[model samples]
Target: MTGWLGNRVITQIGILVHDIEQVSGAYAEFFGVDKPPIAETDSPDMAKTRYRGQETAARAKLAFFDMGPLQLELIQPDSEPSTWREYLDRHGEGPHHIAFVIEGMEEKVMLLEGRGFPLQQRGEYEGGRYAYMDTLKDLKVIIELLENDKR
Candidate 1:
């Protein structure tokens, strides 16, 4: 399929929660798997995080579960101005975004921006980068783009 994104395959689903440990524990029980470790996001220097078009020190505690063809991500944001925090504040705990593993993340983001869905938040991890697009008003949910560095 073809769209604004470089890739069309959805690789993950993200959920926002107030207490990750509690929610992740429940998911672990339901899946009959060990609870994934909760980890903090990269610092602003390392991640180069941006929120609302400006540099910000926003981060979240995250846990991930690989559920067959898709990964389930649970997020508990700090008191920072991150996308996670913003969504949780306005919408409460629930599905936050669906993610696509993509290539040419910057180019894809540019294309989306040209179409009016501007980038809301972005950050870099160890081997990949992620961007949250402001698509909720149009798509009913935010779209997250994940681009792994080519090895």
Candidate 2:
């Protein structure tokens, strides 16, 4: 898999949280680690899709921290009825998915889909693409493919 995706590998573990500040603080306090920097993003397509048949905006707050070789991403969505919000509503707050940094992401996603792994979500961010695969059948977990980029 790493060969097919170049040299990229599992570089991050993402956990969705309902309250960014509270969850981030709890992790910091429990692990005695410094808080990471937070980044905010808005996508017009996401907003339109989320508010389909209505009018609204898609806004999210994200924070990333380096934990040794892996990064931890905390996400909080301000938009209503979004993927993040929906996940939180269904599952509460905890480890949501594990992200694998990969190259040729589109090809990989296509291959996976052909092999019966349909994508749960896909979007572009910071010059890279991300696709989530529903791995519930095999691992009871979700897998995320992330293209390498500064974001």
Candidate 3:
């Protein structure tokens, strides 16, 4: 709790899926909750999308469900060249990453890189920044860091 991750809480679990509508409903039924809200990434969301540090136009459709302390995220990758797309292409639909709500995201990313996990993808949204780390090989799952806007 006192390391690079600090006291930040893990606020999300991202699942990569092929179809948002289908999976969202299924997940809702399984969880015994109403269907979650779905949102599509705009062009601006992918304006700075990067895979292995190179920018690309990777897009995604996302659904969110409030599950007690954390939000469950379902991601359906578009045709753009992105980490989600790569994940889907390489491994098909499944649990892709677990995300931590962090602060000083860049610094944490550097610390993780120093520990041998490189940044795999990054994007900035209205009130936060998110980056995915290449920890799949070592940890069996990717790690996503989210730094919400302080304001």
Candidate 4:
């Protein structure tokens, strides 16, 4: 996998929260760290995502905070039935999924899907695209593919 995806794994962490501000504040209070700057973005092209043969909005408020070598992302969805909203609604506030920074995310998703790894959800943010691959049969965890942010 490393050979195929040249970039080193920069971050791997599960982001959990009911509210983006609350979660980000908890990290700051617990780690005695200041919140990193945030960036706001909205693109109609990105909002029109194909999910289950239907177009859906992907509007969100995302902020990245530095925690040692790992970065914690706080995501607040602006649409119904979003991954974040689903997690919060179903499980309350908790670890959503572990993300793996990688290259060629689309290709990686295809390979994983072909290998019987069921994709629970997939979408794009301001920074990059990501997919949640169910690998419970092997490791009992969902693997996330986060492509590097080119913008």
Candidate 5:
């Protein structure tokens, strides 16, 4: 059967972690690079976060490592109810999501929803939109779709 995500490259791999600092250090060591910069959801662009389709006060501490064309994202959910927190509660610290960049994200989301993948969390930033699909049962990892507005 075909998947709703269509033909696209997996651009990111997100890992849910308990400690961003420690995980960043470990990843930096593994990648033979200095510590990756950590970014929070406090930016004006990402002023709001959502969980399960509802606007939420949840926040996450994030660090990103650049690996050529792909990115490795480390996410630590602060004491809030969110997809990352839920993943941590259910599976502990481990691989969480694989991301794809797509155009017409809302339409893609609807298509995926029709294929049994429901939106678990979604948010927006100034330049892009991101949504996590609950695809763990089928793919063993949540699927994240990112769409950047072409400027």
Candidate 6:
């Protein structure tokens, strides 16, 4: 917990998959839970997605499973350039990132960047924003920061 990012808890673990429907079904069977619904990422107007510092129309199909303390996320990226697509292309279907629900996203991003993990992708969702940090070299996995807007 006393690390660079300062947070100790991971709220979600993301996995990259080529076939979201198949994987979601498999997950549901394996976990003995109902198959979660598949959904797509927001449009560029709403997501405001950016990858490697440039704006992009990155979109992905997503399914979420609520575990006890951590959620499992399945991501199937479109052809557009994005952290999810890039990782899927390079590494194949597997673990992508561990996410931390946080406050002061910009500050945490700066802190991680200062420690040499550059920001790779960022986007906005319905109620919050997310940033993917390129921490693979150092930590062997990307780090995702999620900040939900306060009501």
Best by lDDT: 6
TM-score of each: 0.96, 0.78, 0.93, 0.73, 0.92, 0.97
Q: Which digits, one per residue and each the tens of the lDDT, describe model 4 over residues 1-151?
A: 5643354464766664657777677777787878655444365476444443345564566678766787677766655555566666766666666677887887887788788876766766667777777665776655677886865
The best-first sequence of candidates by TM-score reads: 6, 1, 3, 5, 2, 4
Best by TM-score: 6
Model 5, C-alpha of 116: deviation from truth (Å): 0.9
Q: Specify the poorest-scoring 10-residue window by lDDT in model 3.
A: 41-50
Evaluation by lDDT, superior candidate among 3 and 4: 3
Q: In model 1, how large is the Cα lDDT of residue 125? A: 98
Candidate 4 global CA lDDT score: 0.65
Candidate 3 structure quality by residue, lDDT tens digits, 1-151: 5666885577889999998999999999999999988897767544467788787887789999989899999999889788899898999998999998888998999999999999999998778779999998888999999889877
Which residue window of length 10 is worst by lDDT in model 6? 1-10
lDDT of each: 0.93, 0.72, 0.87, 0.65, 0.86, 0.95
What are the clashing pairs of model 4? none
How displaced is residue 120 in candidate 4, in Å? 3.1
lDDT comparing candidate 2 with the true structure: 0.72
- Off by more than 4 A, model 2: 1-8, 45-57, 149-151
Task: Evaluate residue 1 in candidate 5 and report its C-alpha lDDT on the 0 to 100 scale.
Answer: 39
> Which pairs clash inside model 5?
none
State which candidate, 1 or 5, has the greater TM-score.
Answer: 1
lDDT of 1 at 97: 97
